[model samples]
Target: MFDSLQDKMESAFKNLKGEGKLTEINVAQSIKEIRRALVAADVNYKIAKEFTDKIKDEALGSKNILKSVKPGELMVKIVMDEMTTLMGGQATGINVKGNPGVVLVAGLQGSGKTTFSGKLALFLKEKKSMKPLLVACDVYRPAAIDQLTVLAEQIGAAVYKEPENKNPVSIAQNAIAYAKGHSHDVVIVDTAGRLAIDEVMMTEIRNIKSGINPTETLFVVDSMTGQDAVNTALAFNDVIDYDGVVLTKLDGDTRGGAALSVKYTVGKPIKFASTGEKLNTLDVFHPERMAQRILGMGDIVSFVEKAQDQFDEEEAKRLEKKIKRNKFDYNDFLQQVNQIKKMGDLKSLMGMIPGMGKAIKDIDINDGAFSKVESIIYSMTEDERLKPEILNMSRKRRIAMGCGHNIHEINMFVKQFEQMRKMMTQMSKGKGMERMMQQMQQKR
Candidate 1:
C-alpha cells in the first residue's frame, strides 16, 4: 500500500541510529528527511513543513528527558505520535442510531462508492448485527443499479432501486420510507457521481441529503488519486458537509496522502478504509494502527482482531483434541486453511505481523498458493483425508494423476503434511518446546 513511503520513513529514522541522544543537528537532519518522505508521498508541502516543525520541537524537548531511550527509538516514538495526530487521533464510529439510520454516501465516479457501499452493508450486517438497506441512487449510470443489486445479493442485504425514476432525491426518500416499513435498521443511499465535480452532481447530492436528512453523510474517495483525493474530499465537504470520509482502493498504489491529509483538510474523521475487492475487506480506520503500519511497525492489534473475527472456539477445541490424539488429518488442515482465508488476503494478513512486512515484501505470496494446496487435498479420497497413514506410494501416484501433479510434488506435500501433523501433535502435548530446547542444548 504505502511501500514507498514506508521505505522512505525507515530511511528517515536511520539518521538517528547509533546516536547518543537527540541533538538539534541530528534532529534537523532526520526531520528534513521526514519532511521529504511526506512530500514524496504526495502530502502538501505546507502541512509537511508544519508537521515536521512540531516533530522537531518535540524531539529537542525530549532530548535530555529520555536519556535512557535510544536516539532512534525516541525519534520513532515522536514521529509515531505526530503521525497519529496528523490522521484522526481516535477511531470514529458511524452513527446508525436512529430508527433506520440513513447514511448518504457521496463521491465522484469510479471512486469505488458502489463497491464500498456493499462492503459497508456487509460490515454492518456481520459486525454490528444491523440490517442495512442498500439504495441505488445513481440513476445517471446505466448499470449502477445492477452492480448494486449483485453486491446486495452477495451480502444478503436488501436493495432499493427505481430504474425509471431519474430523480435521486425522490428515490432516496422512497428508499428510506421502504426501509421504515421493512424493519431495516440502516439505509445506505449510494448517490450518483460524476467524472469530475460539477454543479449537476453537487446539486443532486445536496438535494438527496436534504431530502433524506441522513444521520451520517460519508464522502468516499479513491485514495490512489493522491492529493486529488484530498481536494475532492474538501470539495465534497464544502458542499454537503459530510460527517466523515471513506478511503477506497487503499490496497492499490496508494501513497498515503489522502488518508493523512483528508481529516486535516476537510475537518472530518475517516470512518472506513476499503482495501482489495473482497466484500469482507472493509475496516474501520484506526489512525494509531495506521501510523504504526506506515512506520514499519506492523499493526499487531488489527491482526489479532481479524483473527478473532474468524476464530471458532468450538472448532478450536475439536482440533486441539484431535491433535493431542495424533489425529490431525488433511480435512482438519483444509479447514484451518479456510479459516485463515477468511481473515483476509494472505499478503496483507502477513504484513500485519511485526517484522514480516519487510521479510515478504519481495515474495510473490497470493491466495493462489492456497488454491494449489486445496486442489491437492481435494484430489485425495475421503479415506485418505481422514487417515493420513494409508497414503503409500501407489496411492500417491493416483493422487498425482488426479491433481495433474507429478509424483514428486505429491510426495513432497505428503511429507510436509506428516511433519506438520507430528509437530502439531507434539505441541498439543506440551512437548514441542521441550524438544526444541533439547535440540538447541545439543547444538551448543
Candidate 2:
C-alpha cells in the first residue's frame, strides 16, 4: 500500500549505499530525500521536517558508535524506528471488556463506516468468540439499514435497527439493551456520517456517544483522503473523543500518509485497517509490522498470523492422510484453494513475505487466476475428479467442453495435478515429515 513512499525511501537510502559510515554530508543528503518523500506522500510539512530532523540527529549520533553496520542499513533502522513512533509505536486492542461492550463508530459518508462495522462484527465473532450485534443508526441515508442488514447476514451476525425510530441515540440505546438480553456480548453502533465534517453530524454522533457511553469509540476515515483524513480525525476527536482510529480503503492508498500521520496528529492509535471489500480483509493495525513493510522488509509475522487464522488442523490431518495414500485429488485441491482464499487476496498475502512486495509490485495477481483453475476442476465428473487417471481422450474432450476450455488446457491442468499429487505423496512419507505434521497439529 505504501508503494510510492517505499520507492522514494529506497532512493533516499541509496545515497548512503556505498558510504562506509554515516557522515553528516551523506546523512543530510539522505534526510533531505526522506523529507521530500514524506511531504510528497501528503504528510504535514512540519511533521515531516521534525521527523527527518530526528533521523538526522540519530544518524549522526550513531555514526561513530556502530562502525560495523553499513550506513544504508543504519539509516533504514533509524527511519523505521521514527516511522513506528509516528504511527503509534505498538498495536492497541479495542476495549470490549464490559457486560456487553458498546463500540460507537463514526466517520464521514463514503468512508466505509458500514463496511467496517460488519467486518468488525465478523472479526469479534470469529476471532474473539464474541457474539456481536451490528446496530444501524444511519437514519438519514436511504437503505442504510438494509445495507447493514445484508452485511450482518453475510457474516452471520445479528442486526439491531429501528427503521422508523429516526433517532440514532434511541436506536443505539435500544440496540445495547437488546444485545444484553439476547446474549450478544458486543454491540457495535454504526452512527450516521456526512460528506464533510459539519455541526449536525458531529452533534448527532456526540449525542449518541453520550447516550450509550460506549466502551470504545472509533473514528473511521478513508486513508485515500490523505491529510484531510487526519484533519477529519481531529474534528471528530474534538467532539466525540474517540478511543482509536480506523483507516479504511488502505489498499488503494499508495502513499499511505493517513495511516502514518493520523495517529501522530490526533494522538490516537490506529486500531484497525481495512484493505479490501471482503469482510475478512480487516486487520488490527500493527505499527511495527507496517513500518517493516514500508521499509521493504515485509511482514512475515502478519503473514503467518493470517495463515494460522485460516488453518484447520483436523482438515490438515485428513489431507495429509489422503496425500500419503496418493489420493490428493481435485476435491482436496479445491478445498486447499478455498483455504488460501480465506486468507485474503493472493497478491496482498504474497506481499507480506520478506522481500516479495518489490518482486511482484508490478504484477497483476488476482482471484481470477484461481477461478480459471477452479472452473476446470468443477467441470469434472465425480469419478473423474476422484480418479483422474481413468479419463480417456473422449472424456478429456467432454471435460474441456464442459469448462469452456480447449483440450490442450485440460491436458495441461491434468498433468500439473498429477505432478502435485506425486510430489505430495513423496513428501508425506519423507523423514521428519511426521514431526512436522505433529507441530502443525499442535498449533491448532
Prediction-by-prediction clash tally: 0, 0
Q: Give the root-mean-square deviation of each candidate in angstroms.
A: 4.5, 1.4
TM-score of 1: 0.96
Query: How well does model 1 score by local distance difference test?
Result: 0.90
lDDT by residue (tens digit), candidate 1, 1-444: 799899999999998888888899999999999999999999999999999999999999999998899999999999999999999999999999898899999999999999999999999999999999999999888799999999999989999998998889899999999999999999999988899999988888888898889999999989999899999899888899999999999878889889888888888999998888889999999999999999989999888788778766567667777888999999999998998998877888888898988888888888787887888899999999999999999998898888898999888989999999888887868866446434434443
| lDDT for residue 334 in candidate 2, whole number 0-100 | 92
- Give candidate 1 regions above 4 Å deviation: 431-444
Candidate 2 worst ten-residue window by lDDT: 431-440
Which portions of model 2 show Cα errors greater than 4 Å? Answer: 432-444
Instruction: Give the lDDT of residue 172 in candidate 1.
Output: 92
TM-score for model 2?
A: 0.97
